[model samples]
Target: MRKIAYSLAMVLLLAACNSESTDKSTAEVQTKQEVVHMEEALLGKWRGMIEIPQSPLEIILNLKELSGSISVPAQGISDFAFESIKYNESDVAITINLGGSLIKIAGKLKNETIEGTFTQNGQSYTITLKAYTETPVTYEKLLIPVAGGELKAALEMPDKGTGELVIIHAGSGPTNKDGNTIGAGSNNSLKMIAENLAEKGIASIRFDKRGIGDNTALIKKEENLTFDLYVEDVKAIVDYAKKDDRFNEIHLLGHSEGALIMTVAAQQNDVASLISIAGIGRPADEVLMEQLSASLPPNLLVESEKALQQLKAGKKVETVSGQLQSLFRPSVQPYMISWLKYDPQHEISNVNVPIIILQGKKDIQVTEKDAENLYAANNHATVHYFDKMNHVLKDVEGDRDQNLASYYNPDLPLTNGLIEEITKFIKQ
Candidate 1:
């Protein structure tokens, strides 16, 4: 009887172990079923915050899973669409082609949460996200009575604490608050500058042109947007800065075309100081001619030479294709032509205020000569040039090809020298 009892006990133990195994298998099968049933609605508008190493920006992904088309909105540019959204279930990957850059996302789904990584320009970053239903939009209409026109302005204060206020005006193109323009092109340099300033307890304000970003309402009326019109806008911001106690002083910092506006605004406003980055000393037309000549290789040098002549003669060159329209547009040409009429050196000479001229030696768009001319014209202005810095104010070196690659890279921080110099000058 004892032997029989022991044998029965061993049999019961084996049955219990099998039952536990079955229960575990059943749980796993249910989990698999739940995962399979969870439809990846990558469709619709997904919104999240992206933290690239250098700075953080808001992201809006308008994705259509079936068509493989996605729209990305960041900075001031909205719904700038891209093609080919490919997915991999095993790696939980999603990728899309953005202009010349490839944007890759590695995502994982757990229960109801979705998280992942995003890589751009050879740099990878962690981006945690969940399925969001609400679409993110960044545009508002505001009235500026001083400017005599209701425009789209970021009326809200900057994320940074107010110490000194820096107002940025974009260059020849429509540098919307987001640093982007349709047809032409936009860079995130302005946004990057704002982020760095925030870290140093400095505040900044940037706006779209009369017609760009939330200002699209104004663009319909073309006559409203003259160079002077833009200057007036800067004045309105400067007035705000002066009246607001948060800003100890207001500094006008312009990039490219905005730089020209700064020279004009500085002459009129009681600005604390002025800074010009990648600004042209000559006219826009002359800069374009010089740029085309410099960008072309030895083999294509002759074609570029003839194209320059056509441009000078007020005729568009057919052979001068491939990114030419981006630099020279009919809408922007008038501004560029008008800009060429005024010399920045003469403008800088008029400013009695202290000035700092920072230029990137490797900036192909605006050469170091442009900065030199401004420095030469102003005997008292402080000048600093970085041989490795590019137009975006990021540290760069080597051939033109490698330098240009930095344009699309979001991971690379803006050159440390630029921030230190500008901050010191503003404080002084």
Candidate 2:
């Protein structure tokens, strides 16, 4: 019964990603296995924990017949409503619309417990449930203006007049204000940073990227998304901080892809400083090739190079190989074309504000070399290297696989140097 429910859930997930998925038959066949008793089993409050790496994050869900909400109360995320609840055979399944991304949980009931996996963005989390405990902390739900909608953000303000704010820019994809998205394990990197910054009397605002979280419904077609949209989104937040008298200095702190976006955004805003955390220092295309060249099939790699050249030339390729579609799909080419135009090195060189470049020797994604390149362009920038940190700012020491595994480890605390460095820089 467990196997059957899991299989059906996989089909549903695939269908959601690409409606024309080959699993059309599997999706069609997955129906109500039994509705009566299963629904009753899912009622009331449920509590579970996802154990990833050294961190264990707790989850709580409250469900009625057709509705309920799921939240990670530990991280101050409470009552994110669930849109779909269904009983598939003797097994049960529930779907939650996280902004626009859908997360599905499927499992079989055993001895008054529903044991299953939470699947999103091709990442699977083992969720063992029984029921909720403890009231959660109060986190301010802020609405910052954007193109089509006000990008919702989690704002943690300092008690007194630090008179400074750091806009925390999440990496990429559907990453929410908390620095988590589908497929990637929920590490809560950005959320942790904001909370930590508050302790140091520094306020921070972290928002969901457009087409994600509160802004998920903004873009109907993926093909219509552009890199400029994100740049504008960051600018909007800066404008908000400028108007609010709570802060006099507005600084930008971006991680991974957000780091590069901040470089471009800094040019348009009167920010006090820019902090690039694990930001790439090369052209987008070059960084992309380095990441994919080793993993892609020979034939697919050849085809990808051709498509990349067209994109770099400010043209989009009509078609890409099926295997390569995940990266170079027609729907995403427009944004890719817009993104490839920026050289992180060049952008950093042009920044009018003081810059701090950080790198982790253990990060498998953007290496130490990238940080060195950024320093080369901006010789006046302050550079810090952490030998213990990984890409997500987690304290991980070891080979690539072991370090990468920390993504799922909810118990692991972020590295030590980040807060100390940022606090000193901002307060100074």
Give the Å error, residue 325, model 1.
Answer: 7.1
RMSD of each: 18.5, 8.0
What is the RMSD of candidate 1?
Answer: 18.5
Tens-digit per-residue lDDT, 1-428, candidate 1: 12232232233223332333322221122111112222455445555544543233345555444332222332223443343344444224555544335667666655544567777656566665555665243323345544545655553244656567888787764456645443223356777787677778888777777655555444433334567778888888787667777778788999877888998899999988999888888765567656666676764556555555455555545443444444443444444334445667888899989999888888877888788888988876888988788876678877878777676565677876888888899887
Please state the error at residue 318 of candidate 2 in Å. 1.2
Which candidate number would show the highest lDDT if scored against the true structure? 2
> Over 4 Å off in model 1, which ranges?
1-41, 44-148, 155-163, 178-187, 221-224, 294-333
Candidate 2, residues 139-215: lDDT per residue as tens digits? Answer: 56788877876777777887764888999888877667777754345787888888888888888888777665555
Question: Between which residue pairs do clashes occur in model 1?
Answer: 75-178, 76-178, 171-257, 283-340
Q: List the candidate 2 regions with Cα displacement exceeding 4 Å.
A: 1-61, 65-107, 111-137
State every prediction's TM-score relative to the real structure.
Answer: 0.62, 0.77
Model 2 misses residue 78 by how many Å? 11
